[model samples]
Structure formats: structure tokens, C-alpha cells
Target: MKIRRLASQIVLPILMVASTPALLHAAPLEPTRGGEGGRIIRVTTLAKDGPGSLKAAVEAKGKRIIVFEVGGVIDLQRTILNIDEPFLTIAGQTAPSPGITIVRGGIDLKGHDVKISHIRVMTGVDGQAKLSGWEADAFSTVAAHNVIVEHCSFFWAIDENMSTSGPRFNGKTVKEWRAATSHDVLFRENLAAEGLADASHPKGEHSKGTLIHDNATGITLYRNVYAHNMERSPLVKGGAQVLMVNNMIFDPGHRAVHYNLMNLEWAGHDYVTGEITAVGNVMRAGNSTAPGLPFLTLGGDGDLAWYSKDNINVDRWGNPAPMFGRYGVTKAKLIEKDSPMASLGGLDVMPAKDLETSLLASVGARPWDRAPDDIRVLFFVAEGRGEIIDDEKVVGGYPHPSPTAAPFVDKDWNLKTMEPKSGVYPGQKGGAQEKLSARDEAMRENAK
Candidate 1:
């Protein structure tokens, strides 16, 4: 079904504006099985358009299987596959071979108990790819009960160097195509890449009741790299109730984890009530040397504001010590023999102690360790004479603030400058003076 633009705009806003009322009145989605009780159809024959073949299979039997033996391209041009039946399994004999591409406008599974695996969805056409609706969305199982999308790669082409002036793209600014929502979905072992310069949508977008565990969700991501996805945002306002764990999220466009609660003004729907757990997940910010800001941003205008407690165990920097300098060190080397991050948090969790030690070691010994005998003695004396500034408290007050903390200190530990630092050791100069200024500014800003 084509989504009405007006409805789409109104729905998101209404969800934000009437959050309380909608939560009180919103009905839970009924559980369903997408043709779980039907016959199986092996898709041995390759079709230029896979969706048509899938539709044909569904027509033959209310429930069936579409298997791909010799992987080939299956294109779906803005067509919707509404598998309204129940108990269906579209299994692949094996993951799609390197050359195979399965393009779809979108796959909507409204039934119950459906499983689709071992497929690759490419949204861009070879020559006719457009800024909008190149592939649209590969899989969208709205209101479907128990849906699974595994071992699949959904890719779009994006060109970061282009400049277009229009709704979705304004010159150098990047944009994404608009599409329908996919709910109750499980995306595992998938790779999504944006190759085009003007593709209008982010890769890996999903709705409520979605689980993206153990998947590579970004560019240059390998099979085991579960990079942060720009597409996913929690539908519930106030907080996210999703469980995200043990995923290796690398170089996300935005913050590794985002709580999508801003649209509360539209539908007034608020399904989130508590913290969304991001345990044992590796998150990295993309390295883009552009005007855009890096690092994860929690909430902004048109976005829902959540209490700090609503975010559960999110290790902002997954790898305590990302590769230092030009060379990279193995995790085994940087961590101490019996570091807490190495074992205590289980194989999944990486603790703060481990994180700190790893980072310090990667950057070489502390100033004391590097100092000559005279300097070392002087350093100790300096430490004894200088006041110890509680960095944790200062940073905590302005969590994730730019310019960080290194620049605000001086030899005497007195407040100095307010302007952000620049140069080789940017935030390392003016010490106490800079820090106090920043602290006061932050406090005043908070008060305002």
C-alpha cells in the first residue's frame, strides 16, 4: 500500500503531541503467522523480478517457500508484496552468492510466523537509479507477528560528495528516500551499504518490535561487525523498550544508539516507558572530515527527550582503546593481565576500568611515566602543589560535551579561558582557568 504523505506527516506528529492519550488508547498489535501452515515452493527458476515470483508462489499456495538455488538478481520496482497468509517460510538454501542481488520496492509480511533469510536487497537500479524510491525499503513487515529477516543485505547507493537543491538533497547535504515502515522484524547477519550519492534514506530502518541482533548494519562492515545503523530509531516516546545486546556496531552515521521519540507530536503514541538496553555492543562514529558533527547526539529539536536513566548500559566507545596512532593493537595486548574489562563484565560487557587502562596504555605512559628524573620529580611536586580537578564530575555535568576536558587545565589549576582550545594538544592548555570557565558556562546554560 502506498503511504499517504499527509498521513505520514500527521501520524508522526500526532504520535508526539498526544503521547499520553495515545498510550492510554493505543491497542497492541495482534499476533500473526505469515502462512506458517502452507506448502513450500523452491524458487529454482530465476526471475528478473523476485517479488513477482514470490507473488506467484503465494498465489499457488496460501503458504509456501521460495528458495534460491542459483543466486541471481530479483528486482521489484516499487511493488508491494502483501503476504497476508500465515505460516510461511521463505528460506534460502544458502546465503546469497557474492554476485546475486534481490531488489524490492518493499516486502510487507502482515501474517504470522514468517521467516526470510539468505537474501540481498539492492535498492538502486544500474542506470535508472533515482534520488527517491530507487529500491524504497527491502523488507517492511508491518503489524506482522513473529517475523524474521536473516542473512540478508539491504543496500542503497549514496554519493556523499554531491550537491543537489531540492526537498531531500540540498547541494552537499545528504538525504534518504521516504518509505513505509517495517515492524516486528528480526534482521540478523545482514550488510547494508549506501553507494549512491543521493539516495534519500538511511540504511537499516525498522519500526517497533524489531530486533537487530548480530548483524553488520553499515558500510565496509564485515560479517561479524555489527556496526551502528543510521536507519533504526525507537518508535516509542519518553524511552525505548528494545533489547540491543552483543552487537558489534561500528562507525554509525549518528550516535550508535538513538531513541526516536520526537514524532510524539503527531500520533501521540508512546510505547516506550523504560531504558533500552545496549549491553556489550561496539559503537563507533564515522570518520567524516566535513562540517557535520561526529559522535552520538541523544535528542534534539523534533526529537523526543528522554531521562538519562532511560539509556541502559550503553558503552559509547565500544573499544576502550580504538587503534592508537597509525598502527593498531590487538585487544589481547592492550588489556592488563587481569583487567576488570577483560573478564568481569562477561564476554559481552566491557567495563570502565578496562576502557581507561586500554586507552592510557595505547597513548603511552602517563606524563609521570614519560618524565625524566628531574621532570618526574618536578611532576610529582607539581601534582602535590596543584589541586586535583575532579574530571568525572565536570564531564558528567556536561555529558558528551564537545572540546572535551583536556584543554581546561593549567599548572596552577586555575580557571583561564572559555573559548574551545585548538592546536596539537587542543584542550590541554590553560588548565584550571579554561575548566572553570567552561564549568561556569555549562552551569549557567543548564540553569537557563
Candidate 2:
């Protein structure tokens, strides 16, 4: 498929004089306060490849708000900036055009308390063998903590579009997500698309979207839209406390979600699966799509599954469609929680109606730029040919191949309840008379 990443280039002296003052100004130009409202560092150059340009601005001195004075494509030709600084922000919203687009390279975010907003990353748009590692994904962190990625776009990474993992990749160990162990990480109001087919990690034609690898913790995925890729619209692999809510997955080339418990991909040790709570999630087949792609994949022996509630198949306009016809989803029992979800653990589950409305309003970069409406990404929309995506060469194989011996149990059992709760129950009672109203309702309705 033809992929289009939004970006621009730099001019000479004229550009410098025109944009330098905007860069030096301290006014708040980003969507929200990042770097905890720290120093302002503006990116003045749009050079296709350079050292003291965009790359240097991000890795500048200390904690700061990094904004772009000019917006356009920066073809890095396979260079990756390892963002090891603490308390930093990459604000693409400050760009004048369609926002900053990076082609042929991606950054590895290793710092703490960082925010990446309003940018487009296309690591595979270039036909080169690719400069970075296989998993250099559009955005990745080995062990970054308190990181927030929102209102951004990623497509056609040689690896997954977005991911997090432990420090171990092979025999080599990285400090990204290793010693610190990621926690309180949030991904919201963003769009992830087309994980391109590549040979580096052969299992995935372009396998993953938002992939959370082993040993991460306290993740919150809220109101995002993931579309047209091989799989892993947020795959939960040996994660520790993940709360996924109000996200939509559209036209997946394979399964939409997988909770992988048994994996041998890492070099140091075996990967262990973690807990997940999925609420108000929508998985829908897109228009003019291919056939035979399933909606969910529970890896070999079906071991990992956690709390799930209120998932359905529908388009952006709320039109219903089969998530996948092969699986009889409505009656299947597919999810499991570490403990009963009744007590309502630490997850802050919002009312479905409110969450859906809010998400539809804010799923993309602009308040009105919802994914179904403004997302015109072409990689996933067009590129599905010549790649062999059978059982073996799937799961974006890297350190190890994902186990596909057992077929996924089509639907979630949610066996904790006699059945999954279907109606809207007020999440938190507000009025003083709510208890009295409950009693009165019980008395009125229980008599027969």
C-alpha cells in the first residue's frame, strides 16, 4: 500500500530569520502543559537529515517543552534519537502544517515523565533496508516511566507502530525499560495504523500496533483508534496492570487483540503474561475489506485473559457488523481476571455512553479529527499482497515466534458473572439519596 507521512523540509537563511522568534517565545503553543510546564525549546530547522536540528533540539539540555517552529518531513535516513533525558516533551502540535512527520527513522524514548503529541512517524515509508533495529518502532521505550503519548499518528514501522518492553532484547540488555520498570504510562487520543510487512521480524507481515511486552506495569489505554494492521491493537504480553477502555479497532488484517502468556522471545528469560481490564472497547470490520481475519487471538493453551466488559462490533456511525464471523462471540466465554472484577479494582472505568461520546470527540489530534473521519492513512488501506501470513510467520516474529498451536477461544466467557453485565450502572453514586432510591426501586420491583 502507498503510505503518506505528513512532513515538510527546511529552507536556508530566509527560513531562519522568519521562524527563529517563534521558537524563542515562551507562550504555551502545545495542546497541554508537558514537561510539567518546563522550559521552552523550539525546533527551528526542517532539514531532511542533520545533527543540530530536530534531533539536537529534543536531546537539548534538561527538562523542557520541545516545540516545532516549522512543520514538515524530516527524512532521517535510518537514524534514531535515543531520548534518554528526563522530563521532556515533543510537541508536534506547534508545527504549522499537518504536524511533524518523520520518515525512515524513529526515536527510542527512554526518559521519564515525557510526552509526545501531534506527530506522524513512518519508519517503513522508505524502501531502504532500514537503519534502525527491527523493533525500533515508531515509538518505543525499554523502561521509560510516566510517559504519555497522545494525539499522534504512526504507520508502517518495520516493527510494531508503538511498543514497550523490558531491558532485554537479545543477549544485549538496554536500560530503557529494564531497571526502572515502566509504570503509570498512558496512551490516549491517538491513532496507530499499518505495521508494514518486513523480513526483519518475519512472523508479522507488519504485525503489531500498540504492543506492551513483558515486565511493564500500570498502563492505561484510553479513547484511541487503531486501524488496519496485522494485529496487536494493544497486545497484552506478560504485562502487569493494564486498563484498556473506550478504544476502537477497525479492519484488522488478523486478530485485533491477544493476551499472550507463554512466550520465549526474550534472551534473558521466559516471558510471563500479566493482568488486563478491558471496558467499552469496539472491534469493527471496515468497509470493502478482506475475509477470514479473526477478531481476537488467545495464544497457545489459552492461558492469559482478564476482566472484559462492553465490547461490540460497529462502525464509526454506530452501525453494527460482525467483528469476525468465524467466532461466535456473543455466547463464548473468553476472558479471565486474576480476581473477581466485582469489587471494582483500581481501574477507573467510566460510563460507556460518556466515554464513547468523549472519545468520538477527541480520538485524533484535533477535537473534531476523529480517526474514522480524518484518518486517511494509506499503508494499511492498500498494502496486503505477496506476504505469506500463515500460522508460523505471524505475531511479528522477533526474538521468538508467537505460539499459534491453539486457536483462540472466539469470545470472552466473563465467567465471573452468570453473564457479563449488559446495562449502564452508575459507576460512582453521587447523590445522597442514591441509596434510598436503590431501596425504593428494590421494594417497588421485587414484590411479584
Q: Determine which window of 10 residues in candidate 2 has minimal summed lDDT.
A: 14-23
Clash count for each candidate, listed in order shown: 69, 21
Q: Could you give me the TM-score of model 1 versus the true structure?
A: 0.45
User: TM-scores of all models?
Assistant: 0.45, 0.64
| Global CA lDDT computed for model 1 | 0.31
- After TM-score superposition, what is the CA distance of residue 260 in candidate 1 from its true location, in Å? 2.7
Compared with the true structure, model 2 gives a TM-score of: 0.64
Runs of candidate 2 with Cα error greater than 4 angstroms are: 1-34, 48-52, 129-135, 168-179, 198-204, 263-273, 287-295, 314-335, 338-361, 366-374, 377-448
Q: Give the residue spans of candidate 1 off by over 4 A.
A: 1-38, 48-52, 59-61, 78-80, 94-100, 125-135, 157-184, 195-197, 200-240, 267-275, 289-296, 300-448
